[model samples]
Target: MAEKKANPALMKPLTPSPELAAVVGSDPLPRPEVVSKVWDYIKKHDLQNPQNKREIIADEKLQPVFGKDRVTMFEMNKHLSRHLHS
Candidate 1:
């Protein structure tokens, strides 16, 4: 039997555009890099609401992607997909 590898399409690095840069930063990054940068921003800015640790407060740049003032961490990955391409 042969083992199957993860889809390369899923693993391919996505180049972030200017719209993404405004949210994540000016750094030119791939999808995984963007995710890490976003997390770093969340941590550094202390954007997670205290009452609900899962809820993140959207900043000026993050607002466009989030489509609201707040979002749950669980929903973050799904939201990210909108900005990424295959």
Candidate 2:
């Protein structure tokens, strides 16, 4: 059997917008890494709603990226897409 390689596009480093940079830093990073860093920040700040783990409560720095006080975990990627560029 042959092995499949990871998609190059997903591995490519991307720049984050100013709003996202506040949470994940300004360094160019792969999409997965960016997501991971954002999760780390969320955990560090205890931003996830205890009553509803699927919902994330936005902090001051996250307000711009989230565009609301709260959002579902599934919607986070949708919002994040707007702030990333190659």
Best by TM-score: 2
| TM-score, cand. 1 vs. native | 0.76
Among these predictions, the greatest lDDT belongs to 2
TM-score of each: 0.76, 0.94
- Model 2, 1-86: lDDT tens per residue? 88998789988999999999999999999998999998999999999999999999999998999999999999999999899999
Encode model 1's per-residue lDDT on 1-86: one tens digit a residue: 89998676666777555556676765444676788888998899899999999999998878887788999999987887787654
In model 1, which residue pairs have backbone atoms overlapping below 3 Å?
A: none
Q: Which 10-residue span in candidate 2 carries the lowest summed lDDT? A: 2-11
* Clash count of each predicted structure: 0, 0
Against the reference, the lDDT scores of all candidates come to: 0.78, 0.94
